[model samples]
Target: MKMLVNVILPIEPFNSMVRDGSVGEIIGRVIDDIKPESIYFSEQDGSRGAVMVVEVPDASAIPSIAEPWFLNFEAHCEFRIAMTPDDLKRANLSKLAEKWNGVHA
Candidate 1:
């Protein structure tokens, strides 16, 4: 399945890394490892942040995806399942609605 990984990097260590010119190398290592389908960098809540869409094989894969950021940048990470339009179509929501509509509560 595809997962959206949101990473929030703390100011202190992130700034220190940038000042020392290690940011690019570290980020490159992470990018190489995760091999995200898509990635975007921006600020979130006044902190350095990144959003990456990656393929995750299973729940056990979460740590491998998240630990790099945590260990390198002391970052906070959140993961959410993501689906393409075709994946959503496969869900058969109309059938679910019909089944649930018959229930009182």
Candidate 2:
């Protein structure tokens, strides 16, 4: 499965790392470890953040994939299954809609 890992780092440690010039080295090491399919860095909700897409063989691998960011940057991390356009096209939307479209109402 492919997962999107969203990382948001707090300003304090993040600024410190930037000032010390360790930010790139830290992020680089994790990138080397994960070898993500895609990665993007940008601001999110007024915080420094990154979004990376990587393959996860199983649930247990989440810790290995996430721990580096947490340890290095004191980051708030979130992981979610990500879908490509082809995957979305293959979904059984009609059935899902029937199942839940009006259930809340």
**What digit string (tens of lDDT, one per residue) describes model 1 on residues 16-84?**
999999999999999999899999999999999999999999999999999999999999999999999
Q: How big is the positional error of residue 6 in model 2, measured in Å on the Cα after superposition?
A: 0.8
CA lDDT of every candidate: 0.95, 0.91
Residue 52 deviation, candidate 1, in Å?
0.3
**TM-score, per-candidate, Cα-based:** 0.95, 0.84
Q: What is the alpha-carbon lDDT for the whole of candidate 2?
A: 0.91
* Cα error of candidate 2 at position 71, Å: 0.7
- Tens digit of per-residue lDDT, candidate 2, span 1-105: 899999998897989988999888988999999899999999999999999999999999999988998888889999999988989878978889998887874
Q: In model 2, what are the clashing residue pairs, if there are any?
A: none
